[model samples]
Target: MTTLYLLGSAAPPVLEIASVIEGAQKRGYDVCLGLTPSAARWLEPQLTDLEQLTGHPVRSEYKAPTGADVWPRADVALFAPATFNSLNSWALGLTSSFVVGFAAEAIGKGIPLVTMPCVNAAYAQHRALDRSIAELRGMGVSVLYGPDGFEPNQPGERRPEGYPWHLALDAVARRTA
Candidate 1:
């Protein structure tokens, strides 16, 4: 069974991520989730549902029940709807939160890291963000999607219609099969 780490972001995408988690469970993967603080607010109820669906805890902080122990090796680490702040923080090696810490540790261990960033056009077009994204790519992190051909400053405007949970799970399936 593939161990999936569901890293979270903020709202609008929270609903999408819940759908993704449900999809992932239907596909029969062992899913474990971690959410950023902002993402947490939008996903509390959904988190409990995810835990019930996956039969494991949905972690949001390093103090979570599964933290600081030797974790079961994951097949992939996916960050859907990755916020600009979380992306920048991860790109710069900051691990103040559980999601960030897990991503950092996974990267260091050479786990396949995939990110689908959700951000406004102005932030997405910033030079610093560009550099950070480039750096993450250089480190072999695969970015699944981002804003394109969308108006500036509109939150969650450029997200794809369906969540790419299957794509992420397929990647893991191929690797572990």
Candidate 2:
């Protein structure tokens, strides 16, 4: 099966990651779930099930330098609900977290990477956001944002279900096909 590295940040949409994993599986991907540390904690209760669903361990931190990798190499990648922090950090090549680190390296590894951010309008207004988006685009990453992808909600408001998860999957489909 084609392998997909499905990564998420601490955004609310991460609560529904099971459905997204199922969606990727249905599309013929062997999903490997990676999360930011905060997200791992939030989904701790469901980690075992997620690992069972993907047939691999849920990873949030890097392993020892001498250890072998636990999951298979990814053929494609999707980072949905990438918070303002994740998006900028990835673009700037900061590998502090496992997800961001893998994403930064994936760019150089020639992985087909796609990202959809879920920031509220308030955080979206930051100047760094635009630059990050542009930088990732220049690196050949498929960033589904603005009117074409995720539309930011009001700062204090959230509708995690409204995140365009399918858009990211569809982009994955295009690349994998």
Candidate 3:
């Protein structure tokens, strides 16, 4: 079972991620979702659906389930709709939430980490954000999709409906194929 850790934040692009996760499962991949507090609010129903679909519990807090000893290992990690706050936090090694903590741990374990940042053009242009991206890349993490132009407040405006999802899944497929 190739474990996929789907990390997301409160950004609107979460709808895109919802579609991606569902699509990925349809293609026969085991997915585990980890959501930031803010992202949880936007995707509450989908989170439950994801759990049912993947047969693995969705996690939003570190203590949700622990002491299992043999935690599922991820083959791929994708952070979509990565908010600026979460990005900065992750880049600085701050794991305040389950998603962030899982990401930090996954990266530390040398798993393939991919992030698709979804922030407004203004925030994306910030020097700190740019530097953080560079630092993450330098650490061998792939910015799977980002610095792509996106306007704020558009709930489901994906660049090419399903293209980004395909790209993300392709990354994992290539490795496991």
**How does model 3 score by TM-score?**
0.82
Task: Write one digit per residue (lDDT tens) for candidate 3, span 1-177.
Answer: 677888888876676665788887876777888789877887786777767776777777777455562237788888776788888888888989878787778777898887777766667667778777777888777776442422333344544553355665666666566
Query: What overall lDDT goes with each candidate model?
Result: 0.71, 0.94, 0.72
TM-score of each: 0.81, 0.97, 0.82
Task: Give the Å shift of residue 25 in candidate 2.
Answer: 0.5
Per-candidate clashes come to: 0, 0, 0
Ranking of candidates on TM-score, top first: 2, 3, 1
Candidate 3: C-alpha RMSD to true structure equals: 3.3
- Point to the candidate with the largest lDDT: 2
Candidate 2 clashing pairs, residues 3+ apart or interchain: none
Candidate 2's residue-wise lDDT over 20-128, tens digit each?
9999899889999999999999999999999999999999999999989999989999998799999999999989999999999999999999999989999888999
Model 2 regions more than 4 Å off = none
- Model 1 residue runs over 4 Å out of place are 64-71, 146-153, 156-177
Better of 1 and 2 by lDDT: 2
Writing each residue's lDDT as its tens digit, candidate 1 over 49-112 gives: 7777767777776775864653466878777667778888898998888888888788889888
